[model samples]
Target: MDFSQLKKEIIEYSKTIGIDKIGFTTASTFDELRNRLIRQQELQYQSGFEEKDIEKRVNPALLMDSPRSIIAIALAYPSKMNERVTSKKGERRGIFSRASWGEDYHLILRDRLKKLEAYIIERVPEAKCKSMVDTGELVDRAVAERAGIGWSGKNCSIITPEFGSYVYLGEMITTIPFEPDQPIEDQCGTCNKCLEACPTGALVQGGQINAQKCIAFLTQTKGFIEEQYREKIGNRVYGCDSCQTACPENKGKNFHFHEEMEPDPEIVKPLLKPMLQISNREFKEKFGPLAGSWRGKKPIQRNAIIALAHFKDETAVDELIEVMNKDSRAVIRGTAAWALGKIGGETAKAVLENARETESDEEVLVEIERGLAFFK
Candidate 1:
């Protein structure tokens, strides 16, 4: 069987199925990335989200027996929303980063991979394959970098020359001995823009990120946000785009190729006050399709309260007070107290003074003090 011809056919087939970019590479152990992961763990820089087993992440053979090569795929998501919603005074909106704008990318990429897998198995009946998107153990960026999908950029994203850094990556480890493509040359020479622009200094250095400081990772956590970074989160409800937006390589590089990736403006940039009180089912109906909703409504709601604080939106003060006085979740209730203090008025101060006597949770009481401290 001519594997080279089969690889060519796979590339052609990939385009028909809405895959924006495709590349192939050997299923070699990612030794460098393994070292980086160890170092990130040592510094306590790792977000607890990643797969903990380092060997499983680097070795393809562990994922699937005797995997000969890996195929990497990328799909470009739009950096700007097409259907623009109007923003006006008295109504503050929270922003979800571009990565989480449209439909959840994991499902979209997985659908593409499932199609590709079927195509490969049709021709080579004995072909064995395993695939993963972001949730998978293998590092998608490491595979894409080696597979020539794109150069690994300083912002810790795989930046395709054509798509900039705004692309979703996925990979398939297979037994096919397909020839590998040459990797792209790094084009981010002498550029410190992404590092300088990071709100929390999450970009420890070019091509390295301390995920603990990354706003994108922090937004997904269910716990209360640390006070120092609260203001730095700005109006971001989910994920952070500062580093990607700061990259000059991404200049004028927006693409609307995938229909499913187009965002609904009102949902992605929904009003902050309404988010404070949105129901579980209501949150699902509006944001469930978006990637940012993966952690469920609590994190998003908590971030919304913080965004209201960031804006100092006086109009949201009433809603913030309600959340502080009535919300069941201590994180939500405490965050509302914090927001109320940030947006202080006679009413905000009164609510906190009352809550100080009634609030029971140790963590909530601490946040109440942080809130009241803002008044001082």
Candidate 2:
């Protein structure tokens, strides 16, 4: 197969498969992107895994059983009008990080990439392809860069002049040696918007962001997060998009997602009270396969309580009371107690006392007391 013809065929096939951009490169796009990953790992900013995890992904042999070439794809997740509602004046909003504001990209990207692979095999009966979207062991951002879809920004996200860093990336590892594209030159010269805007200072240095300090990781993280990081989480109920929001390059770009990715109005901009009231069963019914459900309702519910506390919305006091008094989960009870203190009044204090009397979790009792302390 001629590389030139294969390049044209790959691009055409990707578009047919619903991917917005497609590029090809060798499996070893790791070397160019290693510095950023190492810097984040060294700072203990990485989440989910350590330096060893990244090393495993970068290893082409591991990325694919026997990787030879990469066919990278990008899905442009352009921001919508509802996604930009960040002001304090808005009514209690269901806070979906930009990524969650649409259909789960994993399903969308996966189905499309799989179809593309099937198409390739139909053309070349012996061709084998493995596809991934934000998963797998390969360094996707680096692969995307090599494919000419975008360049890596200081925030460690791939940036395309056409779409900024909002693009969701996926890739196919295949033995096909399709013509590879030249990598783009970095365009984030002297721009520190992503660095300056990080709440936890995760973007500590030039083009370096600590994933551990990243709010998105915290919100999506399973199990209890370090208490110290909890206070810095802000109002993001799911993921955090602050750095991407601050990037000048992202301004004025419009994306029309396919219908599969539209945000559920109820979940798109959720009311704080309803989010708190939702049962685990209801949460699964509404968001189970969606992006935020991966961590279960606990983190998101806890995050809603924190957002209520941040807003100091007295109206949420009754709901917070219910959670403190009735929720079986200790984390929910504790966060509710904490939120009540922030919304303090006679009613808030009463709920805290009730929780203190009956709560079994020692940690929750301690939080109930701490909440009472704020009132005194």
Candidate 3:
């Protein structure tokens, strides 16, 4: 079987299917990434969303039988929204990171992978392939790096020369022996922009992050956000983009290649107050299609409350008061209490004082007290 000719065919076919970029690499164990995962585990810096078994994450052989190579594909997303949301004088809005702007990337990437796999199978009847997006055991960034799709940036994102860091990556492990592409040279030389721009200093150093402190990670957490990082979160409801936005390489690097990648400005940057009261059905109808909605409406609502406080949006005071007093979830109730304090006014202070008396949950009470402290 002419594997070299087959590989060339796959490359040309990939372009016709809207895959922005494709690269190949031998399926050798990722020794460097394995060591880094161990270090991140030791430091408790992992987001806990990653696969716990570090071995499975670094070795492609474990994921698929006799894997000979990995095929990495990138889909570029738009960095700038075509339509911008206009915030009224008293209205406040929260921004979802660029990643969560459009249809969930996992589904989009998985569809592309399936198409690639079928194309490969048509050529080589016996070829076996395993495909994965972000949730899979295999680290997508590491695979992309080895496949020469991009260099690992200081922000811990894969930065392709053509698309910068604003690209969604996925990979397929195949039994076909494809020649590996050379890894790109790291171009973030002495550029501390990403590290310096990190809101919580989550970028501990170049190409490393303390996920625990990352606003992007924190926004996904189901629990209460740590006080130190709450103010830093600002109006980000889903993920943070400070690191990527700060990188010089990503400057003016906006691509609107795929129609599905286009964002609805109103949905991505919705009014902060409406988010607090959105019903389960309404939440699903509106945000469920976006990747940011995977965590459900609670975390986004909690962050929305925090964002209202960030802007000190006096108009949201009434709604925040209702959430503090009546919300079923302690995290929401507590975060709303905290936000009420941060956006203090006579009414906000009064609601906190009332919630302090009626709030039964111990954590909620603590937040109520914390909120009241702002008035003093």
Residue 307 in candidate 3, Cα distance off native in Å? 0.5
Native-structure RMSD, model 2: 2.6
> How well is each residue in 165-259 modelled by candidate 3, as lDDT tens digits?
99999999999999899999998899999999998999999988999999999999999998989999999999999999999999999999999
Off by over 4 Å in 2: 32-39, 49-52, 82-91, 222-231
Cα lDDT of model 3 overall?
0.93
Pairs of residues at least 3 apart in sequence or in different chains that clash in candidate 3:
none
Please identify which of the two predictions, 2 or 3, would achieve the higher TM-score against the true structure. 3
* Candidate 3, run of 10 with poorest lDDT: 85-94
Report the poorest 10 consecutive residues by lDDT, candidate 2.
Answer: 81-90
**Per lDDT, what order, best first?**
3, 1, 2
Q: How do the predictions measure up, each by TM-score?
A: 0.99, 0.91, 0.99
**lDDT score for candidate 1 against the true structure:** 0.93
Backbone clashes counted, model 2: 5
RMSD in order of candidates: 0.8, 2.6, 0.8
TM-score of 2: 0.91
> Model 3 compared with the native: what TM-score?
0.99
> What Cα-based lDDT does every candidate model obtain?
0.93, 0.77, 0.93
